[model samples]
Target: MEKLILTRLNVLGHPGRMAVFRLLMRRLPDAVPAGEIGQALAIKPSTLSVYLSALCGAGLIGQRREGTSILYSARAQAGGEIVDFLFNDCCRGRPETCAPVSRVFREGFPDMSDRKYNVLFICTGNSARSIFAETILRDQAGERFDVYSAGTRPYSQLDPFALEVLKAKGHDISGLRAKNVSEFCAPDAPQMDFVFTVCDQAANEECPAWEGQPVSAHWGMPDPVKAEGTDAQKSLAFQQAYGALRNRILSFTALPLDSLDRISLQKAVDDIARETPEVTT
Candidate 1:
């Protein structure tokens, strides 16, 4: 390990290699052609080879022949290791002082933008609240999140009122469906990145094993469909749920998700959910 670290240091010491390495790191997970890399950095053919060879030899970069062109990319795992090694010994116990390594690469790393977070919203019935949340997040953060909803005891269908409310608000409900939490608990299911239990009932329910042990939180909201009243009153109830959810959803999306560590992000999500603005219905 000592020798490997020394080798990494030696490869990084050269200014030319460092420049190439930095560019590749920024373009990580997406391989850039060798010719384009050298041209962009104004590196001569011969000089680029020396730089690429050194970084490759040190496990700092990887390359593959793509037709006539060679594609080179930073070894993301290797870069992560290098950074971890730098701080692991010191940040072991004092976690507060440790900067978020994900944030450090968030902007520079193209893969961060390309990456999608899988978010699951859950409730007891999956009829109203969970459906609302899944659609809201799916539409708003569709590019950033793959949103889904499920219930421990899922209803046979979506709540008609929930669909009506979203439709009136100009939200697309074509893909909205009530799914069983069991479907997502399967080992073959796509691992969720974040899971929000959207109602008090589901929050307390014994949920099946989740795929990724995703960061879980409860964002309880009252069941709008449960309100028994006049037609006008019933309409207003759904509207209030929509407004309250919209407010919280906006706040949740406003967060710098890529910048915040898990702990901070969890706190932010919980705080947003807890802020149940006084809704009138």
Candidate 2:
């Protein structure tokens, strides 16, 4: 830990490297091409190459090859740790000293707090899985987001078990009806910031182009409505679906949206689908 701290300090010790890192932070969650970074800082390409290499070696920044260009972004985890370490140690007894740093990190990037993100969850029938996600997100962070669910092939109503499990968990089951996805495709419809397909069928279907080009990913899960068995067995399926959607929605709402650019946010949401769900019934 000490070694990493010293390495970060040494990398940022040079003025040129410091300039590069500060510029990268201002563009958090977006990777800047090497040429663009050099141009922005008015540094010669040859000299800038040395600084980029040093920062990358210290794990302060990361690079990825994008076609012919190498793009770099400030490594958020590493940068965050350094800030945490400094704040903890320097302000050990002086808590007030940390406020300015906290304020800067909170307000430094593009402000996304004032706006509520519109998120739509989609499934084939919207009777179960999609409804579960909508309710879960609404329970989780309804104030920060506008959550909705729909189906490609509409169901006349929501699945009974889906409502049963939600009501058991104390989620508001009101105003939840299965609707066709077309309703949200109108010109006057609310623009979505995120769209998720929670069933394989909906994921495979061709979707209408959204107004804002929302970040989308598949969060496919087994359709609990199709689980055929005794009453207890069928109810267990709804519980499992609820658990899975609850876990995913919790993770989604916890993201630091203000600090993440669209590209990073897209990858983050896609990665959530790969994580194992924790059953919480």
- Please report the candidate that would top TM-score against the real structure: 2
Model 1 weakest lDDT span, ten residues long: 102-111
Stretches > 4 Å off in candidate 2: 1-111
Q: What is the lDDT of residue 222 in candidate 1?
A: 72
Worst 10 residues of 2 by lDDT: 103-112
lDDT of every model, 2 decimals: 0.74, 0.81
- Can you tell me which runs of candidate 1 are displaced by over 4 Å? 1-113, 276-281
Residues 40-113 of candidate 1: C-alpha lDDT, one tens digit per residue: 67889998988899899999999999899898878757766666665565566344556554344322312347
N/CA/C clash count, model 2: 0
Give lDDT: candidate 2, residue 124: 91
TM-score of each: 0.59, 0.61
lDDT of each residue in 20-128, candidate 2, tens digit only = 8976754544567988788777899999999999999999999999899999988767877787778777777244778766654433333557788899999999899
Whole-model lDDT for model 2 versus the true structure? Answer: 0.81
Q: Residue 75 deviation, candidate 2, in Å?
A: 23
